[model samples]
Target: MFKVEAIADSYDQRVVDVDTGVYLEWLVTGSRYTTEVFNLVHPGGMIPFTTSREYGVDPHTGLPFLVFRFITFGSAVRAQLRTKHLINCTFTDDLAKKFWMTVAAEALVVFGSAYNGFKVPNRRYTRVEVNEKIYTLEDFGYTTSPG
Candidate 1:
């Protein structure tokens, strides 16, 4: 049996747009990986954005999966945190834990690429439970450069 639980932690950063300052917090969760971006500086909640994905069964492997999803949204109204985006990818059970962990790191790099000035710290945890015996593992860095 192949059963694992993964959690993507959240991070916050303070960004300024010329004169106005805003706080941005990004939260990611779910077995399939769902990301939520919020603008704490503004009174209103989540900002609106466009989401698109390319997902289906691989023609060669014949396995169902989501290749990637792109989220494009505007940053704070006045802050320089403009044009923030996230690229989310799904890893299937066939892939090893290390492979998925590397993929997660790549996703983080892509998400923070726009805001090079700011830093975003991310973490991934994989947990396995069998017959009430639980094992927890964490991956902070990738063995190979996710490039």
Candidate 2:
């Protein structure tokens, strides 16, 4: 008899305010791992606010920023490492067209993999690619990195 392993992961949800074609406060709930990483990922795909004080205005850009702090437990691992992927549907006109093409291609990849009965990792998602560039919250205007 062969044994198979099943790994279980947790998920959480938060509320994100959409206005000014940017991002505002976000309600977050999840494991420390998921929450912290999600915060660092920047919900709106933009950078967080940064300031001299905990919450000060940036002199250079004149945009209010925030300095975030988060501490994680278990194995002394760093709490707020950002992920390098942007999962969005918006793009420049040129990029948008290419993005849709990539989406089609990626969908085909997923369908083909599924058709072939390939075993994909449980949490792993195969999605569209964009310019090999990682998207951040700063691109859309998100302040406050998660810890």
Candidate 3:
């Protein structure tokens, strides 16, 4: 039998409005929103995940827009579960993958209530499915743009 669990360890969001010069950033650890997300997605599981939003003047064009980024950790465990636990009917790897995939697909729907005017980027935004190494804001060049 494969016993699986996933939990949201942290939650964060940043919103920058180039038009109005408004900037917002916040961090919530084990908060109701985080718990709610975990319940909606993984239920009884515990996992590490990241959600981010960027908005401001486009670095390349000086235009205003919004971008969303998502990442998940624990590829080794996810992979092992997928390969070793394919049978026995206790737990399946697909469930693990599905949890993260659902988060990536529906994060905005689940957490976008705070941002009133920010919309998902029309162009293709960056997405890392399973990151072996976590990233920093500098890695994404988030600190360079106007708020």
Q: Which is the leading candidate under lDDT?
A: 3
For candidate 1, lDDT tens digit of each residue in 7-85?
Answer: 2362433232223222333333223444333332233233322222333454665654332232434332222245344
TM-scores for all candidates? 0.23, 0.19, 0.29
Residue 8, candidate 1: alpha-carbon lDDT: 38
Model 2 alpha-carbon drift over 4 Å, by segment:
1-96, 112-119, 125-128, 133-147
lDDT of each: 0.30, 0.27, 0.33
Q: Candidate 2: how many backbone clashes?
A: 15
TM value for model 3: 0.29
| CA lDDT for candidate 3 | 0.33
| Tens-digit per-residue lDDT, 1-147, candidate 3 | 001112237454334323433232222323333311111123243333344445456568555544444433322223233344211112358776664444433333312334332233422232222234323223333333222
Instruction: List model 2 lDDT by residue over 1-147, tens digit each.
Output: 011112236242222222223222122223431232212122335322111112345466565433222222111112122323323234457764554333222222222122210233221221222355422233323232222
Q: Which stretches of candidate 1 lie over 4 Å from their true place?
A: 1-50, 71-105, 108-147
Using lDDT as the measure, name the better of candidate 2 and candidate 3: 3
Query: What root-mean-square deviation over C-alphas does model 3 reach?
Result: 14.9
